[model samples]
Target: MSKHWKKLPWIIAGILVLIGLLNPPLLPWILLILVSAAYWFLPRRGLIGPVTLPADDAFLPSQQVQWWYWTGHLFTDDGRRFGFEVVFFSFDAFVIMRDQLVQAAITDVNGQRFEFEEFLRLHLPKRVKDGFDLSSGAGNQVTAVGGDGHDRLHAQIGNYTLDLKLDSTQQPALHYGGDAHPYRFGGYTYYYSRPKMATTGTLTIDGQTFQVTGNSWFDRQYGELFQAIRQGWQWFAIELEDNRQIMLFDFKGNDSSVEKSGSITDANGLTTTLAAHEFEVTVTGEWTSPNTGCTYPSGWEIVVKGEKFTVEPLVKDQELRANHDLWIGPVYWEGACGVGGAVAGQAYVELNGYCKCLAAKLP
Candidate 1:
């Protein structure tokens, strides 16, 4: 694991891009898929030196494609409960164009789904203040105050508008990495999460509005998006009733070998980094989408650190087609889930990469 060897993928990609100048159509695409496989199969051997992290509010260099992600559970005043996710991705480095996207989805307990996504390529400016403050300078916006642990989420599209405030209750952040340095998969991200938070807001659908309040989870991942991850990933963010939280992500690959990483944040906010071999995830049920005929896992039995849990979706039809083909492509399953077995809790489950062999998020 030398630094020189780690630079090989970019070198190859740059060479392909240069060659693509003459062979426009074919080589560029070949390069795209090649770079993607690098992230999918490449073996990451930790880091050279420890990188201090949980750097909440910390950002990557503007040149790298990066994003801020948040997700949570909500309970409406009338007793309707649902799950939601808000994600921002700046794809400047990947496309050679100043492209950015904001995507949000809500999945209700009764199997109903609503999705909203905004992609802006030519616009004013993507502004950041006090570290985490983000302004899209458009009708759709998300802003996070660095110290307040407060985030304002809003969007206006067609006849629907959503506005919510998230107040994080977990502190110091959950840093997923080595003893001192942050762990980065695909070699470009410094990742962390506020596993438990309080959320309140108003969501307007058509002409009606609903007031909601509940618990949530916030994940902040920033850095190189074009680092290349070939197959998509299956992820889970689970919150137990005992003030404990767990986040697990496994990058799916073709050979049936998946790269696993996760962390458990206890009531005191201390995090325990999980080794890949320390857990096992088994798919217990499958559902085939009539739209694409792509089958996705519907039930899971996860054994982590010797504890077992069963996860089942609150609704079977909770799928979202953000259709972000220019960057991360494919239709994915993201919805609220119920957790049983060793723990009784609520969770958000995501199933991606099931639609095709070559789909990924650059970082």
Candidate 2:
């Protein structure tokens, strides 16, 4: 794509915003047209450059949005288990400025406790070379930085402090078939996941610390995400006992239709894309958050490749209510679950756009 052609969308958006500001009565109509156009055009595959690992894993400020996410299950020497999530997000507010936000959470399965914290900051000169170096909160309370699948993660919230090192064991599973053209639910994104990562870390709470070993999942996605988030999504990453990893996505459009897609990685690091009819998920129960009053689906019965599995949350109240302060804050459920029935494994599920309180305010 030429430089001028690449700038067309933002130029058109700026014009639309100006027109909306000049004519107050047309703002809603303008937004409706923008959304409609996005839905109609974005799903078609886009052409792009080769996507290489360890380098493309770095921050791409050129894109409008990007995020590095990690979710894992850890255990103590005895038997206690825990789930942890740490994500760093970067959203382009302008051509030269970006909004950086970090969210960290820990679910103490044995203790039946969930604790999380959020931090938001602004950075100028949208540029990050080589790899990602992200931190949030005062004195860097949360930090995650690495290249490829070898990474370090740290977070401190409430009485829990987690530090872990992750080493990749398998190749990344590229979603939407391949990197040549990757688009899902009306948006273009270079999405891939490192599903098998050997994790070693320490969890310190109160005054004691325990050495932990487990597995972690790494996801890196960037590109057109503004339209995708408006449509809600339920994402799952499951690591089975037989060394197979599956990543499933159920995206709901603005018109209330559901689109499903996924990728499965075998023990030998081979990944294949799944068609819509190859997988299905049914909600078995619901849980209402006391803090946000959002009713989220609790238990799920997932059928993949004709095999049935039941997934139940380790902690029901894993909702994270964002403390809004100049960034888009939406309450979301990112939690750990155990898989049974046809498979015995661990999974992480993320549910977004469930709470009307903050979701309705998103752009």
- Candidate with best lDDT: 2
Which pairs clash in the backbone of model 2? none
Residue-level lDDT of model 1, residues 164-269, one tens digit each, is 8877776745455533332243445556676777888887768899898988777766544353344467898988888888888877765544467788888888
Model 1 stretches with alpha carbons more than 4 Å out: 1-59, 122-127, 133-137, 141-148, 157-160, 178-186, 225-228, 254-258, 323-330, 357-363
For residue 100, give model 1's deviation from the true position in Å: 1.0
TM-score for predicted model 2 compared with the true structure: 0.83
TM-score of 1: 0.74
Best by TM-score: 2
| Model 2 lDDT, residue 124, Cα | 20
Model 2, 1-363: lDDT tens digits are 565786698799789978998999999999899888766764342335556666778766457777889999999999899999999888774546567878999999999999998888765212345567778856889988777778999999889999999999888888865564344446667788888889998999996999999999999887778776777788999999999998998886555455777889998999999888999989899999877677999999999989999999999999987776564467889999999988799999999878757553343
Q: Against the hidden reference, what TM-scores do the models get?
A: 0.74, 0.83
Per-model CA lDDT versus the true structure: 0.67, 0.83
